[model samples]
Target: MSLPLAIISYLILGESDTWFTTLGTYLYFILLPVFWVGYTVGKKILGIRIVNLDETDVSFWTMIKRQLIANIFYILTLGIGVIVSAFMVGIREDKRAIHDFIAGTYVTFHPPWQK
Candidate 1:
């Protein structure tokens, strides 16, 4: 999604649109899952779902808190926080991003064979 948005923005608005497009793309991922469902449009389509760390239901308020810490906070540090979060996800054995940890949540995939 970020790739596609960045591509379109580059084609239409030149290189300067790259940052805006990138941020917008990330914001979209944050918004949909927190407000609409427990997954972004892409995640929903791919059978990926987000859940509480304890395998319990997560309320809307918790999701909002999660997004604030995970994504929105990036703006406070000029994206350094976001970079760090990505790095944490890459290095951590559990693959949980900083936002996941902050929100106390987990992302999982639903297997077709199981469901």
Candidate 2:
């Protein structure tokens, strides 16, 4: 999703290639500590939010670890790892993907009425 969005941003912005948007998007998501709002814009619209394994608020470093395990390394493998991770989610009762396992985080529903 992030990579696709970055590619779209790159195309819309008249960029030469996806490198800039991809790298920038990766850096922004991985390095920044976007707390409080666990969901990105799309996730918020979908009522999904990322949380720690213990259902606690996550810190900056935790997000970093998440991005590394779930996004960067997985994506670096030409999406093979991400595909496997998706299967992990489907096979598990808890629905935690490999990324969730690696990052010590999971996603939960955010009903609109709750917040």
Could you estimate the TM-score for every candidate?
A: 0.61, 0.68
Task: State residue 20's C-alpha deviation in candidate 2, in Å.
Answer: 3.0
Instruction: List model 2 lDDT by residue over 3-107, tens digit each.
Output: 666667767877645666766666656544254456666667777877777676556777777776567678688889888888888888888887677778778
Error of 2 at 103 (Å): 1.1
- Over 1-115, each residue of candidate 1 has an lDDT whose tens digit, in order, gives 7777877787888873578787787677666676644677777788877777765545676676687656667788799988888897789887787778778987777432333
Off by over 4 Å in 2: 1-14, 31-33, 75-78, 111-115
Candidate 1, RMSD to the unseen true structure: 4.7
- Residue 6 of model 1: what lDDT? 78
Of candidate 1, the 10-residue stretch with the lowest lDDT total is 106-115
TM-score of 1: 0.61
- Which lDDT values do the candidates have, in the order given? 0.71, 0.69
